[model samples]
Target: MRQPTLYLPHGAGPCFFMDWEPPDTWARHRAFLENLPATLPERPRALLVISAHWEAPQFTVQKHPAPPLVFDYSGFPPHTYQLTWPAPGAPLLAEQVAGLLQAAGLACGFDERRGFDHGVFVPLKLAFPEADIPCVQLSLRADLDPAAHLAAGKALMPLRDEGVLILGSGNSYHNMQVMLRAWQSGALTTHGLDFDAWLTETVTQADAVERERCLIAWSSAPGAREAAPREEHLIPLLVVAGAGGNAPGAKIFEDRVLGAVQSAFRFG
Candidate 1:
């Protein structure tokens, strides 16, 4: 069986760690996770996360058996700073990924000092609370160009066959313009809903060629500029889609946030 790879629209910082009580989006977030383990193919030997937070000048890998905390976000509750997902780090696989990038003639770097960023820990803590599986995070490059990112992902393609669950953890309808708007208005707006619909139709079309084309031209999608304004969240999707290649992506979880954001998709 082809191991599955996910491109999840992880909610804002530390949202996944919150419980079901406050009647916010976190409850739904947790539920999506509760059902994910069973939905995935038998667990991979390790998980390779392409987090939006860890961007470098080029591709970089975390190389350490036990990683530390990065606390990349700020202004949240103080307890948020103390949170730790504690998944074992895969320095061996990290070296392997680095080697692959070098072999592919791409600029690659490493940081044994790096640790879990919320782009990694937040959704991961929910998806694998046990933290038993070894995890490796590949940082994004400063370049947000779609074609460049696709090549970066293709370089890591070999790892997929070696039982690494490559996950692109970022948002789909990540309109920072809308994120702040949602926070203030406390409701989904027209642009969010429209962009989300366009995204669903584009991914669910069942045409490999078309999906690939759409991803390359994603910035042109309806409300695309407004939705992504910054392409980091969307770039993560390119990694997963590039890994999928000719395969059709499985729709993992496509849902709304604040009734507007399109948090969606999983691909093989």
Candidate 2:
């Protein structure tokens, strides 16, 4: 069976492993991640993850055979920095991914030294706690072009049938400035609702062509800018959406975090 492509919300920096004023702040999201593997068709042979954290001038793949963790986020609990997910790196898959992108006329490169950032480890630690799967991490292009990332994803569609689970790790709504203000003020803001609704509709559209078209023009959607001041956090979805091909997408999970609506999507 072909592995499904996913776009998941990787919550605020190691939030799942720490305590918050509201002790259960990350409980729902953590549960969602924990339950993710059971929902898959079968155990994946490898995982190809596109994270919001890393961006290169060109599309890049991590080639480190024994990859380490990157403590990308700051000011978290000291123990959070020491969290571990010792999954083996997929150097061969890195070459395969680069080949796929290059064949699609997309610029690609490799990094043998870079490690998995929080975007990859934080969530995967929950979903695949054993960390036994061979994993490859791909970088978003620094340009952050939606169509380009989508094309990169389309180029990678072959991996699905080969037992590689394609995952896009990002938050659906990622305007940190706004979210922080709302959190500090204890204000209940629904600004992300419109964009969340629009995004969910676009990705879940039965017509793949239409879905791609809407995603390319996503900046014009209601609350688009407010939901993503910087597109990095949302760009991974474009890749997952592209890899989806003709498969219909479904909203697998949804939650309100820090006054912003976050969601997870599965394309198959």
Candidate 3:
């Protein structure tokens, strides 16, 4: 069976492994990640993750045979740094990914040195705890162009049939400044909800052309700039949306975190 593409909310750095003041701040999101595999069609042969954490001049793929963890985040508990998922690297899949992009007329490159960043491991450590599946990490382009990333995803759609689970790891609402301000003020912010609602509607549209059109012009959506001052996190969704092709998207998960509404999406 073809695997579904996922756009998941990778919560604040190492949040799941630490104790929060509210104690249950990340509880629901953690549970969602832990239970994700059960919702999959089958065990994936490998995983292809497009993370917001890494961006290159061109789209890049991790080609390390045994990649290490990058420990990309800081200021977390010492135990969080010691955290390990130890999933093997999918070098062959990296090559396949590069080929797909090139064939689609998209620029592609390979990075043999870079390892899995927090964006790849933090959520996967909860979802695929066993760390048994081979995985490859892909980078978003530095340009953060939605249409280009979508095209890159469309090129890799064949991987789904080949048992490669394509995942886009990033939060739906990623404006730290806005989130921090709301959290400090002890007041709820509706910008996140406004953007999430528009995004959900755009992705779940029955008309693929309209969905793509809306996404391509996503900056115009309600609260778009407030929700995503920088587009890296939001860009991953476009790739997943593009890979979705004719299939309509579904909002699989949603939660209010740090005064912002974050969500996860799935497209078959």
Q: Please, what is the TM-score per model? A: 0.92, 0.98, 0.98
lDDT scores for all predictions? 0.78, 0.94, 0.93
Predicted structure 1: lDDT: 0.78
Which structure among the candidates has the greatest TM-score?
2
Better of 1 and 3 by TM-score: 3
By lDDT, the best candidate is 2
Candidate 2 ranges with C-alpha deviation above 4 Å: none
* lDDT score, candidate 2, position 42: 100
Once model 1 is optimally superposed onto the true structure by TM-score, how far is the C-alpha of residue 105 displaced, in angstroms? 3.0
Question: Ten-residue segment with the worst summed lDDT in candidate 1?
Answer: 16-25
Please identify model 1 stretches exceeding 4 Å from their true place.
Answer: 19-22, 188-190
Error of 2 at 91 (Å): 0.9
Kindly list the per-residue Cα lDDT of model 1 for residues 1-268, writing each as its tens digit: 4577778877877876554233666676678876777876788799998988878988899997898778888777788888878999998999998898788787888988898888888888888889999998998888877877777677777777788888998887666666666667766454566667777777666887787788788877778887877889888988877776666776667666654565667766
User: Roughly what TM-score does model 1 have, to 2 decimal places?
Assistant: 0.92
